[model samples]
Target: MRFATVEEPDGTVRCGVVESGVEGESLLRLPAGTTVLDLIQAGELHAAGERAQAADDAVPLAGLRLLPPLDPPTVRDFVAFEEHVEGVVQSVSGGAGVVPEWYEAPTFYFTNPYALVGAHDDVAVPPGSGLFDFELEVACVVGRDAASPTPDEVDIVGYTILNDWSARDLQRREMKVNLGPAKGKDSATTLGPWLVTADELLPYRDAEGFLALDMRVAVNGVEIGQDLLSNMGWPFEELVAYAGRGTRVRAGDVLGSGTCGNGGCLAELWGRRGAQDPPPLRPGGVVEMTVEGIGTIRNTVVAGVELPPVRPARVRPRTRKRTS
Candidate 1:
């Protein structure tokens, strides 16, 4: 079943299932405050969907505003695609490939879930960001306990497209300090169009059990990158399992399959763009990402609150105390 959150004409937000009719699409509104996360946590998705179907009021899709399926409790993004990681690493490190430790385990980083925006929303580039970029990827919402021996057997609520907006310049500078990507990525992440249940994607699963969905990204209606989800070196199951190893992956948690092969952001394209660095995303630039089985999310870049460039005060060397 496909589900989404919509804004009502009365300035109220509601969760509903996408219903198709002769006139485009409509939303079968569910009970008040019935969010997608609520259904997942209660494991009552099917029952809730049935209830929505019978509701009398069906709002036109075009008239309502869609929100990210939910405000994810925790967001973890992983580097699961080899081609994407390889190209990015080589581009930044002058031909260096994946490190030895990378193959031994599926690695991920926590992102700020509070900044998440739904499909068709406007995203603003953080102030002082010179190389704004977008990452085209897929994300899943956790529904069941991840401690199960067969992680893949856990209930997966649904899948949606993820747009990990980036500040390339800030990322490069901070990561050089041997820390994780923080401020550079904290701005915003785009999710939705709607959520597709796992059962709906069964037909697209390959023999190896990896999804075969094709992911594509375009800026201002011009295609920039495309890749197949089957190209992931580490599947979603592995990533989720690894994440729950010593911690709990509760319901509403989100795990992202990092950028796909050649999902060229300015950083990756810089090496190939020659002396002319690809222009950063400007205000009003539209970025669209589509994934089969899921759907397309188009976002417009807008100007954020501007701030002066970061400047830190110099630190003086201190003398060490002699210990007896």
Candidate 2:
């Protein structure tokens, strides 16, 4: 089943199951104050979904403003694509391949969950970043709560397309300090259209248990990147299990399969463009990403606030005491 959160004409947000009819698309609205996150938390996804479907007063999908399927409790983005890892490593560290540790584990980092926006929301380019870029990825939404989750216990309810919007220049500047990509990436992350259940994608699962779905991204009307989901070195299960190492993997946790191959982002594109930055996205620029089973999410880039210069601490030179 496909699920979505939508804004009504009265400015209230409602959760629903999206259905395709012979005439057009419509939504089976759930009860008020109940959201996609609530259903997942209650562990009543199937039962609640059935009840929502039978209710009357459906809304046309076209008229409502779609929001992020759900705002997860925590967001963990992992680098699962080897090609993307290699390309980005070569671009930033002048290395030829991935780090040894990258092969040992599914490396991930926490991102700002509050920065998330939905399908049609306008993304603001973080201040002072001219080399802004986008990371094309697919994210899995965790469905159940578990501590030290095992592979079998990794209950992923649905999938969504994710745009890990980036400010490359800021990222480069801070990563040199070897501590953060924090402010550089915390500005915006886009997820949406709707969430597609894992069962819906069962046909695309391969013999090795990895998905074989086609993933692609386009800027404006031109295709910029394409790669198969099967290319991932670490699948969603392993990533989620690893994320639950010691902490609890809650019902609304999100685990993202980092950027895909070749043209996933300008960081990788920088190498292809001969060590130069890819054209920076400007106001009015449109970005669209599509995953085979899930849906497409399109967003517009808009102007943001200008940032202030990095503050510097005053340094005082110490007078050496006479050793004699």
Candidate 3:
């Protein structure tokens, strides 16, 4: 089943069941004041979906505005694609390659859940960033809380497209200090079109149990590249288990597979080809990403709100080295 959060013609927001294609034509409305998150937490999502299917409160999908499926409580994005890591690392690190430690376990970073952007919304180029970029990926939302659940024990409710927007210049500089991609990635993340239940994608699972979904990204109507979701070095189940290793993963939390291969971002291209051919995304640019079964999420880049200027870092002189 596919689900969405939509704005009615009256400007009322509600979660509903989207019927048919990625371009759904109608939405079977659920009750007011109830969100998809609430249903997931109460373990009534399937029941609600079944009930909505029999109701007569059908609304034209074209008359509604699609929004981010749900507001996640916490979002953790991981590097689960070996191709993406190798291409990006070598590109930015001057011919360096993926470290041995990367293969030992999936690594992830926390992102601002409040900044989740809608499927067909407008995004602003984060201020002070000249190299704005996009990452093509997919993510799964947790349906129940789990404390160190095994891969087979994870309770993933659905999957959706994820755009981990990047500010390369800011990220590159801050990461040089070995600590952050903070301001660089804090601005936005895209998730939606609709959320497809886990069982809906079962037929696409390959012999090895990896999802063989096709994924692609484009900038301003020009195709960047495409790859298989099965190419991921680790699967979503493992990622969820890994995320719950030291802490509980609560309902409504999201875990994203890192960027796909085929150069998900211009930074990787710049690293590989040694030129910024297509250049970074700027105001007026449109970024569209598609994942088979899940759906497509497209966003337009708009002018951003610039913050106050900052002074350069202070240079401290060497003074008390003998204490060591």
Candidate 4:
């Protein structure tokens, strides 16, 4: 079943299912406080069809606001696609790239859960971002706590689309200090039209299943990136297992499969070659990122004002000297 987080005309956010075609009455908005993970655990999804047909004061898709599907426990975006990694490495280092040692160990970075936006929401392009970009990815929501669950114990409650929006100019400037891809990346991250469950996607879980799904992105109506999920260098199962090692993963935790090959915004795609293209996303421009089986996420780019300066991170002095 496809599920979503929607807000009513009265302005209350809730979880629900996508009941209509990609457009009409699109969301079957659930009651307030019903989390995406809660539906999976309670098996409310099994009754979705009946619920959608019945009119029992539950909110309908037509009058609700859609939000990101889950209240995430932790959010981490991984570099699991070789082509995407290679492209980024080449652009940064100007040469062929190997999987970095950290990457071999399933590296990830935490992002602001509060900053998430839903389908059709407007994404404000940060000031000074002359090169705003988009990264198309599939995100997994963990369904249970597992400090180290065996592969079989890992339960992926559902899947959603994530756009790891990037500000290339800010990222480049910050990287010179050897700290980020932080603030540049922190400004915005988009998720959801809905979450598709395991049962609904069982047919696509085969050895050839990964390749069966198609993904694409368009600016206005022009296609920029297109590829199959099969192109990923690492599979979802391995990513889950790697992340679980020495770490506690709880329900609602999210894992993002980084940008697909050719999925970078026009800046990353064209800037490396020395072209001085302006930002791909601009005020009034529309962007649509889509994945087969899941659905499409559309956002309009809006201009942003400067945010308050981030306070310097507090560093605690070491309390003990290293014996070695």
| Candidate 1 TM-score to native | 0.93
Give the poorly placed runs of model 3, Cα more than 4 Å off: 21-24, 315-324
RMSD of each: 2.6, 3.0, 3.1, 4.9
> Rank order by lDDT, top first?
3, 2, 1, 4
Q: What's the TM-score of every candidate structure?
A: 0.93, 0.94, 0.94, 0.84
Model 4 residue runs over 4 Å out of place are 21-23, 40-63, 92-96, 99-103, 208-211, 276-279, 307-324
lDDT, residue 66, candidate 3:
87
Query: Clash totals for all models, in order?
Result: 0, 0, 0, 4
Clashing pairs in 3: none
Q: Per-residue lDDT tens digits of candidate 2, residues 35-105?
A: 88888888877677789888855889997888999978899888899989878776665667778988898
TM-score of 2: 0.94
Tens digits of lDDT, candidate 4, 1-324: 787777767776666666655456555545557667675555555475357546444444654566887767678888767767666655543455555674556666777777888888899988667777788888887766778776677878778899998887777767678676777788778888888876676777667435346889998888888877767766676677778887878777889887777754554465344454424677888889888888889898899987676577789877687676
Error of 2 at 272 (Å): 3.4
Local accuracy of candidate 3 as per-residue lDDT tens digits, 79-198: 888778877775555556688999999999998888888999899988888889899989999989999999899999999999999888888877888887687888999999888999
lDDT of 1 by residue, 31-88 (tens): 8978888888888887898888977468789977788988778999998877777666
Candidate 2 error regions (>4 Å): 316-324
114 Cα displacement, candidate 3 (Å):
1.2
lDDT of 2 at 49: 75
Q: Candidate 4 clashing pairs?
A: 6-65, 7-64, 7-65, 27-61
Who is ahead in lDDT, 2 or 4? 2
